[model samples]
Target chain A: MSALLTDDSIVDLHPLHIGTEEDGAVEVGRADTGMFVALPPEGVALLRLLADHLPMAEVRRRFGDSYGEPPDLDDFVAGLHECGFIRAVDGVPWPEGDDERGATEADPAASPAGGTTMRGIALLGGLGPERLRWLLSRPLLLVFAGVWLAVPALMLADPSLAPRPSDALLYHRVLPNALLVAVIAWTLVMLHEFAHALAARARGCTGRFSVGRRLVFLVGQTELSDVRTIARRQRYAPYLAGMTWDLIVVLGCLCCELAAVGGQLPRTVTYTVALTFIYQFSVFMRTDIYYVIVNALRLGDLMGDTRRLLANAVRGLRHSEPAYDLSGVPEREMRIIRWYCVYYLLGSSTVIAGSLLLSVPALVRMLRIAADGMASGPAAAGFWDGAGFVALVAFQFGTLGYVGFRDHRRTRAGTAATAV
Target chain B: MKIQIRKLERIETTVACACGS
Candidate 1:
C-alpha cells in the first residue's frame, strides 16, 4: 500500500467523503467542480462496508473470496484519484476538523485545459419556433441585412462609380486587397458559427456564446456542449460549415461577375470573394484546416499538450523537478502528445515559410503602389495619397491594439481577483 | 377541527418524526 502511495505521489491531494445507506450501498457525492458520481453496484457495496481507517489488505480480504481474484483496491483507488473522487493522504496535509470533503476553487487555472466561463453571453434556451420567428423579425437586424444587400446592388448598377476618398485611402493605399479579404473572411466566420448554433439548437442543446481568442486570434462563437459528447460527424460540421458557406458565396460572386453587363462590380465582387476564400484556406495558422487535422487525429487539447511538451522539454534540459508536471497525465495520452509535438515542430516551420514566401511579393507590390501614389500626389485630386494611407494604417493598428489590450487587462484582472 | 373556506379548498397534511418519541 505504501509502495503504491510512493509510486503515485499525489501532492495537494484532496480526498472526498462517501455516505452509506441502510441498503448497504455507498453514494459518492462529488463536491469539487460540481461533478457527481455514478459507481457500479460492486464498487458501491465495497465502499459501504470498508472501514475508512483500516489498511488496504483488510479491505481486500473482506471481498477477495466472493469476487474471485479480488479486484485490486489499489487500482480502484488510482482510478478514483484520476477521476478526482479521492486523494492520497500521505505527504499531503488536511485541515484539522474539515470532514465534509469537497474541492475548493483555490486555483482558477485548475479547470480542464481550455476551460473557460462564458461571459457577456446567454444560451438560446429551447426557444419555440414561434419565438424564433419573432426574434428574427426584429426591425434592426432585418434593416441591417437589407441595407447590406441593397447598397452593394445600387453601387453595382450605378456607372458613375468613382472610388470614394475614404475607400481609396483605406482599401487601395493602406491595406491593398487584404482588407476586402478580411471583411469577407469575417462574414464567413460569423456564418460558420451561426450554423453551429443552429445545429445545436436543432439538437435541443443550448450553446454559450463568447467573443474571445482561440489561441492568439480573436473569434466569436458559441460552444454548445462538451466536445467529448458530440459525435465525430457533428463536430466536423461547425468547423467546416463556414468554409462551405464561403465556397457558396464565392460561386455566387463568380456568377455575378460572369453575368454582369460590363461594370466594375464584376471585378470588385470577384476579387473580394476570391481573396476571402484564399485567406480562409491559409491553414498554417489556427484555421478550419488546423481544426480538421487536430480532430481527425482525435487529439483532444492539442494546444495544452503542445504547451506541456515545451515546458517539459525545457525542464528536462535544466534537470529540475520538471516545473511542468507530467504525473497527472495518463501514459497513453502522453505518448500521443509526444507525436503531436514532433508533428507541430515540423508543420509550423513549413507554414511560416509558406506565409513568408506568399506575403513578400504581395507586400512588395503594395509598397510599390503606395510609393507611386505618393510621388504622383497632385493638389487637384485631394490629399489622399500618403496622409490617407497613414490614417488608415493607424486606424487598423489602433483598433487591433485596443482589442489586444482589453483581453490582456481582462485576464490580468481575473488573475488578480483569484489571488485575492 | 378546521375552518372551511368559501371556495372549495383542498387541505394538505405533513408528517414529522421526533427521535425521542
Candidate 2:
C-alpha cells in the first residue's frame, strides 16, 4: 500500500517469465526466485508498457486511451513492488522482504532447501532422476489402470477380501500389530511421495518430500511448487502420481491376500493401504486428488479464496462492510467454491468429531488394558505390552501437537517479519 | 472512471499441496 514513488520515479522492471494462461490470467514472475503472480490480460499489457520504462504519466495516459479509464498509477506500481514483482524502484532495487509467502517456501529456517528437509534422499539411492522418470511414462498408463481396476473386480468376486478396519488388527499384542502395519504404511507413504517427485523430475522440475500435518492426521506431503510452471496437461501425473503408487501397492496387497500366505500381514497391509487411499479422496483436506481438481479446473488458490469469500460474507453481516473485495471472484469459480464449502465443512467436521468421539472409547479401552497390566507389575507377561501401546499413543499425539505448533509458529513469524 | 487491477494470487506458495498416508 506504499505510495512513495512520484511521477518521475524511474522504475527498472525485472526480467519476467511468462507462464501459461490459467483461465483469464497469465502466470508471470521472476524465474530465479520462482515467485509468480497472476495478472489479467489488461494488467499484462500494462506491465508490458512499464517494462519499456515509460514515463509514469505516459503509462497512465496510454492505458486510459485503451481501457477508457486510467488506473491509479502510484498505487498499482507500489503494489507490484510490495509483491516483489518489481526489480527496482527509482533506480534502487526494491527490498525483497515483502513477499512473506516466498519466504515461507524458500527460507531455509522455515523450509529446508526450498520445501524439503530430506533433500535428494527421495530420489532413490543417489541415482539420477532420469532413472525413475519412466515410472510416470504415458505407456505405463494402461498397466496402472489395470492394477487399480483389479481391486474392485476382485472385491466383487469375493466380498470378504475388501479392506476393513478389523483387518488391521493382526496380533494379540498391540505393539507387534502396530509396528508391522506402521512400518508398511510409512514405507508406502514415502514411495507415494517419491512417485510425485519422480513425476515432477520427468518434466524437468525438482521438488522435495517432507513430513507435515494436515488437520488431525500427520501426513507425508510433496512440495511440487515447480509443477505450476509446466503445461496443465503435464501437471496431472505429478499431482496424481502418489495415488497411482497407492493403487499399485493395494493391488500387490490384494494378490498377496489371495495367496493365503503371510498369515495376517497381507490383510493388515490391505487395511492400512486402503484406509489411506480412501482418505485421499477426501478432497477437502487438499489430498492428491484435490490438486488435480484444482489444476484441471484452473481454480487458483481455491481454498484461500473460499475462506476469504466466507469471511467477507460474515463481516458484511456483522458490520455492514466486507473484509475482502467481492468483485474479483469470477462467478463460475464462486459457484464451485460454494459447493466446495459444503464439502469442506462436512469433511473437516467428520475428522474433528472422529478425533473427539472415537478416540474416547479407544483411549478408554487402552487405559483399562494398561491399568490391568500395571497392577500385575513389570515382570508380568502383558505388563509391558499395555505400557508400550500407551506409549505409542502418547508418541503419536505428542508428535502431532509438536509439529503443528512448529509449523504454526514458523508461519506466524514469517508473516510478522514481512509486516515490518 | 476507474480501472481495476486484480491481485488474486500474489505468489503461489503451495505448502503441502499433495498429502497421502
Name model 2 segments beyond 4 Å from true.
A1-16, A30-35, A51-70, A100-133, A316-320, A414-420, B1-21
User: What's candidate 2's DockQ score?
Assistant: 0.19
For all predicted structures, in order, the TM-scores are: 0.50, 0.82
| Chain B TM-score by candidate, in order shown | 0.18, 0.20
User: How does model 1 do on interface RMSD, in angstroms?
Assistant: 28.7
Give all candidate RMSDs, comma-separated. Answer: 17.6, 5.4
Candidate 1 residue-wise lDDT, A1-420, digit = tens? 334453324323344444333123233433322222334456764554342534455556656665655656656654454444444344464322111112223221222212232222334555643544332334843543554465446447762331232321224434434444345445555665565555445443344454433222345445443322334444554455444544455445445645765354444444444443443444323445556665575443444556556666877889866554445344555787787677656665664565468644754665566566667666523234444544544544464455456545444443211100
C-alpha lDDT of all candidate models, in order:
0.42, 0.65
Q: Encode model 2's per-residue lDDT on A1-420: one tens digit a residue.
A: 346576666677767766756678887665434456677777887888888898777888889899888877776676577556777766777776455233333232233111212222234324565777677666787788777788889989999988877787888776546655666777778778877777777776665555666667777776665566778788887777777777777777778778876778778777777777667777876677777788778776666666666666677788867766657667778899888878877887887788678766876776787778877989996788767766766766686677666665555455422210
Docking class of 1: incorrect
Query: Model 1: how far is A381 from its true place, Å?
Result: 5.2
For candidate 2, give the lDDT of residue A317.
81
